[model samples]
Target: MNKTVNQKAWFLVLPVLLLVAFSAVIPLMTVVNYSVQDTFGNNQFFWAGLEWFEEMLNDDRMWGALGRQLMFSGIILLIQVPLGVFVALNMPKKGFWASFCLVFMSLPLLIPWNVVGTIWQVFGRVDIGLLGHTLAALGIEYNYTSDPFAAWVTIIVMDVWHWTSLVALLAYAGLQSIPDAYYQAAKIDQASRWKVFRFIELPKMMGVLMIAILLRFMDSFMIYTEPFVVTGGGPGSTTTLLSIDLVKMALGQFDLGPAAAFSLMYFLVILLISWVFYTVMINLDKREG
Candidate 1:
């Protein structure tokens, strides 16, 4: 006997397919069109072919922005992943405190990105802001606007404060999923703290950690608005990550062709990194299985 597949289920998925095409594919097509052509106002477009792509590839500024973006993402992963794991380890397993902690941890994630940036912008000011006033009183010169180093530090710290909680919460959920029986088995084996984690908890949490890293990497690579609102890509282009540079090309400079090429390259870099991360994670899962 031959078996028939359910064809009607596709109907249920049609709306979602349409939505994604509209939201993602349509915008991507627009970018692709712009990437290969130049318009000299009045909708008069000239074929530029790969000229913009070549220019962007040769641009020192593009390379610098990419370097800065990678650095930012690397630092964020280093800081947030460990910190999140630590926080999860220390959190109460079950009780009102757990509930309270969950709510508190989620508060940062709840805030809008732009609002978070604005808050940090004010919070970092040398006058009227608590951090600024305290640092000033302590005889330290700190100004994100005028100092490149300060601007970099401020953006890194701000991102950490905003997004670390997400990693912590995901890690906590992963920890909670580990059975109590595992801990009991570890105790019976006379396992040390390191052994328990290395053998049991760490393995279990690997999936969630991969997810957290992937999310943070993508976000950091594409981060705009927040850093843009805060630094405005000032202090000598220190914080001009790819996204910032792309915007500057698009709106600031009004060079649509170059901007389009920059954006396509930017998208490809993210896609490549994400693919690598996903492949590694899939392989790890296979090994563990």
Candidate 2:
């Protein structure tokens, strides 16, 4: 006999669906409309078809921004993932110190993104900021505003300081989930530290590690307010990522059509990479199961 489906659950979900439509779907539809049309003030819109998309594709500035974005994200993953895992591995697994460490590690994550950026921006000032003043006193030329390399380093270090704790916390949770039996077994087997990690802990942490990678990748890829506040996309656009460029197009330049198209493409890139990461994560989970 076939079981009857519980249709009443739909009632509970209806309000959430409506809210999502209002909050997300409506705005997305507006972006789609702008992507295909051009307006020259007076509320008059002309059909532009894919002209804006084509222009964005051909724009060297957009491409440069994309390159910078990818490089930033790549560097973040390279630095944060390994560093986070290492920190997690070294953290106390249990006790009073563990609780203290958890609270301390969470401090950076608790800070708002804009506030973090502002803090760094002020903290890097050569005349007053400790970091800048120390570097200056040491006779090292350090200026984030004028030097492209310094700006990039500042942003990268700022991001690392801000987000690395997230990865560490996640990895720590993953490590905590592993049973003591595994370590006991490793000890009985005369396994080395590296061997135990490779054979037991690393494999167990794979799920959370994948999650950390995906999260950091998406955040780093779409980063805006922090770097914008810190660098203002300056030193000759060296630190300008796609989000900054899109804002400049939409608000700064008031070119809605191109900005909308650029945003859609930007959304697609994030969606595509996220899908790839999700697929890998799912496959890994399946294999473990």
Candidate 3:
């Protein structure tokens, strides 16, 4: 006889479902409404019928911002993943030191994002900041406000400093889950460290690594506050990612139609890329299992 599945479990999740609908679905519907219509003063809206989307698609400024966003996400992934893995590998496996390291690694993740940005903002000032003063004292003319390259580097470095710990903690947890038997077997086989890592540790950590990649990619792709606080999309739009440009259009230029269209497109891009990452992770799990 086939056992009947419990239908009562749905009751437990009904509230959560309602909450999501209230918060996410409602806001998304509002954005969709805004995207498809044009608004004039006095809260008047008229049928626009994809006009704003077409305009946004044709805008070179939007495309440039997209390029910058992609580049930043790519660079962040490249740097953070490897560096985080290295830190995880080097951490003490178990001890007081291991506990200390764990706490230390978590500190950066605990700091508020806006606060982190504010700290960096002050920390990078040319005259008052330690970094800027030291660079200046060393005879290097480094000014983020006036220099595009410096601004980019500063933001990239600041992001790495703040988020690499997250990657490291995730990788470390993955490493901890590996059985000691694997390492012992590798040692018995006279395997070199590189060989063991390549054959064993890397595969074991692949699941968490994919997760780290997905989280970092999504976060970096949509990053706004930190860079905005640090650079204000400045040095002449050199650091102006898509989110920054969208805000500027929405609030600064008061182009609500275009901003709404831009937001929907941005949401779609993130959803599509995240789905890809999720698909890859699932396939990897199947292959490994």
Best by TM-score: 3
> Which lDDT tens digits does candidate 1 get at residues 1-289?
9989889887999999999999999999999999999987677789999999999899999999999999999998999999999999999999999999999999999999999999999998998778877888999999999999989999999999999999999999999999999999999999999999899999999988999999999999899988998898878899988898888889888899999999998889889999999998998899888
Please count the clashing residue pairs in each candidate, in the order shown: 0, 0, 0
- Candidate 2 residue runs with Cα over 4 Å from true position: 1-12
Q: How far in Å is the alpha carbon of 220 misplaced in model 2?
A: 1.2
The alpha-carbon root-mean-square deviation between model 2 and the true structure, to one decimal in Å, is 2.0
lDDT: worst 10-residue window of model 3: 36-45
- Those runs of model 1 whose alpha carbons end farther than 4 Å from true positions after fitting are 1-12
Please give each candidate's TM-score.
Answer: 0.95, 0.95, 0.96
Write the residue-wise lDDT of candidate 3 on 1-289 in tens digits: 9999999988999999999999999999988998988887578889999999999999999899999999999998999999999999999999899999999999998988889889988899988999998999999888999999999999999999999999999999999999999999999999999999999999999999999999999999999999999999999999999999999998898878889999999999999999999999999999999
User: What value of lDDT does candidate 1 attain over all alpha carbons?
Assistant: 0.92
lDDT-best of 1 and 3: 3
Q: Which parts of model 3 are misplaced by more than 4 Å?
A: 1-11
* Cα RMSD (angstroms) for every candidate in the order listed: 2.1, 2.0, 1.7
